[model samples]
Target: MYAVIRVRGRTGIKKNIADNLNMLNLTRISHATVIPETPSYDGMLQKGKDYITWGEISEDTLKELISVRGRLPGDKRVTDEYVKENTDYDSVDALATAIFNQETTMKDAGLKPIFRLNPPRKGYEGTKKPYTEGGSLGYRSENINELIEKMI
Candidate 1:
């Protein structure tokens, strides 16, 4: 799975890019969503590259994200009991594993699709430039995990 986070706001955004962001469910700055890796997703990410950052997500980070930020329909925290009661998984860890393995999605697991994250603790490197240029946008490979850690 890939973790995609919106880094910029909507001001001065082109309609096509805004539509891509909306379709990715990253409607606001600092919001994040996990999606399966696919060519279609790659295309969308490319189209909105200037306003977002993404990369393959690690299982550990995915677990931590689910345990800490995953929420139920009523805005309740996900617990082992909840997972046991509602799904085949035994706990949040199992759910995270399933998600990482592409066996299921956050929505299928009964959690909100979007993770509302705080801005990174130390702030971004630069929102206007690509990650290759030491900015916070575009792809960052494994470095995305570090950013997620700070945001979480």
Candidate 2:
């Protein structure tokens, strides 16, 4: 799966890019969503590339993200007990494994789809430029895990 995070604000955004980000459920800066890797999602990510960052998420990062940021319907922190009670998984780690393996989704696992993250610890390097140029926008490949760690 690809972990996508909105990096820019809505002001001055073009309608189509805004629509793409909205469709991805990234309506605000620092908001993130995980999506299966697919052609349509790729197109959407490309459309909003100037205002977001994304890449394949590592299982360890994904697990930490879920354990630290995952929430339930009533804004409760997701725990192993909750996972056992609400889903087939016996622990949060198992759920994370399942999600990483594409065997389940956050929604199906009874977690909220959107993860509201704090801005990266040291903030972005440069939000206006692409990741290839030492900026925080655009795809960052496995470096996305480092970024996520900072945010978490």
> Candidate 1: RMSD over Cα atoms?
0.7
Which candidate has the highest lDDT of all? 1
lDDT of 1 by residue, 1-152 (tens): 89999999999999988998999999999999999989999999999999999998999999999999989988899999999999999999999999999999888888999999999998999999999998999999899999999999
Q: Pick the candidate with the highest TM-score.
A: 1
Question: Candidate 2: where is the Cα deviation over 4 Å?
Answer: none
RMSD of 2: 0.8
Candidate 1 lDDT? 0.94
Model 2: pairs clashing at backbone N, Cα or C within 3 Å: none
Q: lDDT for every model?
A: 0.94, 0.92
Measured by TM-score, how close is model 1 to the native structure? 0.98
Q: Report each candidate's C-alpha RMSD, comma-separated, in the order given.
A: 0.7, 0.8
